[model samples]
Target: MFSKSFVRRALSGLAIAGCLVVGLPTLSFADGLPGFTLWGGVKGEDSLNFRLDFGGRAGSWDRYRLRIPAKKMKLAVEQFAISYPDYYKGEFDTKNVEVIVKDKSIKLQEVRWNKDNHLLEIYPEEPIPAGSGVEIQLANVRNPSFGGMFYFNCQVLSPGDVPLLRYLGTWVITIS
Candidate 1:
């Protein structure tokens, strides 16, 4: 039979080892999202939601669902523009870009990805009515080779209005 002190020590060691075995998985390392911070002065109302269908990894191909709430669309949008930071080098497939309204794909006159200007312009075949919630679908997007915070400002040009782009909201996209 084992001595009393030796038996106690063995049980303690077993407990510690069991804890480690259970806790190790929770502490395992993963390249995940950075801690959240309010880097920009954007207010809650001025923020837009963009979802990455797949985990946004560097150098990975993914799809982006950029959503525009109805409250943000106070004017009928003739053209939608997304202006990203100059350092963002992600590639977009303009041919597969889509505008969705109420789960239906809206026809687009053209979708332009201007590398020099760092803009993705979406022109619908017909003007999107005011107060309509819309989703801009960007397919076959190649994430940049590096991870960083990218601020995408959304602007819209209204039909029969001043030829100036009006600010709608901002999408703060982070690729890990």
Candidate 2:
């Protein structure tokens, strides 16, 4: 036994609440979008490697390199992602970076980013044909330049407060 006015008021309140919940995310997302960049670099002793340059206070960039022996020229990079703190906010611009193999550029497709898992995965549009020595470089990254402590890692996602680190390793790809 309720009046029409009461029911109308209740419905209006619920609608407002729903709109607030939905609108909040849209507002937050609009402020600071996340982006990423992909590049290649060489891994070895006493090498500069690659740079994970940041432009703001909450973003960062990092690079990892792997050297494959001539004998092993085929390997599957099944996993590649970047992780940060739950509070961290930013994006990655993938177009600025390039992946060079034997001085020839390779196309990367199927790029997927998972915020829940804090991972970024990419698969080559075309497989690298059997080849000898290959060099990979990860460069041209734009990230947050604030906080001055933003950190990033390859294969393992970390937070911004910790010491900024990079991953360096080698992979063997054999075509047969």
Candidate 3:
């Protein structure tokens, strides 16, 4: 026969030990990930809403890479353009921007950067088909030498039959 107090103490010790064992590892794992205290999450509606985050040793903004997942068949992109809205006057270079799809480097036949209208139209030699995706590598990009929120509009021109570039959505990027 076990005493009541002895049984209670044993259970209490087991509970405390269980919490420390399970909780310590979770706290450690969270520390390794990027901290988003300064910049908030994405703030717009879009199908391929894979929000991009920027964080590094404060001074270095050599280049940044972003992956834009392929859109569904509804409005497939034949030739797309990253139009820097008429309002935004940030000084980022588009001369060294490169498009890569599925580990293969793609050549953009036309790279138009209209500093006046703030639009960078990128026309690929081969149109990106449905169900495929691409990664946009913005090299030699000096991303806002400061920290804040920057939004970019992505418009797509669908394949045959349609002549207009449909409005997709806005890419909400946060820099911290």
Candidate 4:
């Protein structure tokens, strides 16, 4: 038979343990660079507006939620831009864009582009955890047309620790 005080202490301990278990990961991840940006857009040359929602109430380590509005365009897309600062003048290869969700590789199928719009469609190869986010790395981005362009149309997903030259690109997200 346990006393009232014992029960209360047990409950308090359980609550604290639960909080630590839940909060530790968020804190650990909080220290690392923020994840990728999530943009929204349509297929054709039409413009789409979207919103980015950072989950945390205040401070850093906030998670972002993207709001992609409905559109009457051919395809809804989210775009990001990668640019180098003035000092670093070099060309980047536009062919190396990889999307990683929670360390799992995601396949980005290249969509037929119209002029400068290098489009990619995101189909999650594996099931993504509910609250987990992704990282978008544009490796070898050293092309003439690859830097300093205003990559809009989608929501900016992650707020990185360093000033990322890449605009996190856009997600070819569907808005139905």
Candidate 5:
């Protein structure tokens, strides 16, 4: 007959060995960079597009969605601006900060900076459905001059009387 202590020791050793066989390769690593750090890719899926639209009522927003083409590197037009062409009818050089996606313009309700996370949360004046694929145009910066891996994470604040900022996902902008 085996003693209880011996049985316990044998089970623990077997558990450790089982975990090593199934857990070591799946472990994830991060750079621990906070506040909008760039990424190569997150969780596999990496096609990204920031669609901007400016046709909605107050406190209402249409989803901005983008599908990055296979050749995202060939995007030539560099002059990107985020403005309510439907509101002010102005183009670039308009100091009003905006989120410009591709070559579209839209008016936003508010822009907030999360100092704790170094994240820029854009608040559209409307409600967007949960878990919906959306577009986010960084109205200011142009594509990386030196092509490489650029990452963008999206968080949305639903359009309502009181909205909470929810993290959508991360976008890895690969500029060839």
Candidate 6:
């Protein structure tokens, strides 16, 4: 028979191994977002916040809540543009696009989804006031067929400004 101390040590070792086997998989995100990026030199300030209403799986229909912080909205934006990389082949619901401010939906003048240019342009009926946080809600987004990281850069065009697109931030979206 094993000594009592040896039995206790074996039990503890088994418990540790059991915990690792059960807990390690839970740490992995289904959408492939890591807790921290070690290699990508993306600054925290440049990355925008976003949410996937549905679990962002490949080829799934999802809703995206792309947010613009109040600090970034220093000027009244006449239009907002989201440009993704050419490699991303997701389809957007241009007709159902919305611009939300303070939980109220702003009337959109137009929503343009330019697949060839990889741009989604959203023009509000009126300029979104300065200092108000904005949320671009894409109601019916078709996720890409492949799982990968897509950087969706956000830009804003201010009312009465020289036709220039101001860089707001980037949304690092992940599809599983």
Model 2, residue 53: distance off in Å is 5.9
Please write out the lDDT profile of model 2 over residues 1-176, one tens digit for every residue. Answer: 99999999999999999999989977644322222223332233312223222222233453323333333333333223444444434454455334556767667765565768655554566654444444444444334344432233344112332433234232211110
- Reference-based TM-score of each model: 0.80, 0.38, 0.63, 0.28, 0.36, 0.85
Q: Write the residue-wise lDDT of candidate 6 on 90-132 in tens digits.
A: 8998998989999999999999988889999999999999999
Ranking by TM-score: 6, 1, 3, 2, 5, 4
Q: What lDDT is reached at residue 121 by model 6?
A: 93
Stretches off by above 4 angstroms in model 1 are 1-35, 39-41
What local lDDT does model 6 show for residue 23? 87
Residue pair clashes in candidate 1? none
After TM-score superposition, the amount by which residue 55's alpha carbon in candidate 6 deviates from its true location, in angstroms, is 0.6
Writing each residue's lDDT as its tens digit, candidate 4 over 39-121 gives: 53333333333222322222222222222222221231233332223432333333555555546666654422223433333
Clash numbers, per candidate: 0, 33, 0, 31, 4, 0
Candidate ranking (lDDT, best to worst) = 6, 1, 3, 2, 5, 4
- RMSD list, candidates in order: 5.4, 18.8, 6.2, 15.1, 16.3, 2.9
lDDT of 6: 0.88
Q: Would you list the C-alpha lDDT of every candidate in the order shown?
A: 0.87, 0.42, 0.61, 0.37, 0.39, 0.88
Best by TM-score: 6
lDDT of 3 by residue, 13-101 (tens): 99999999999987655421233334454443452333222342233454545556655334446676677545443455667777877
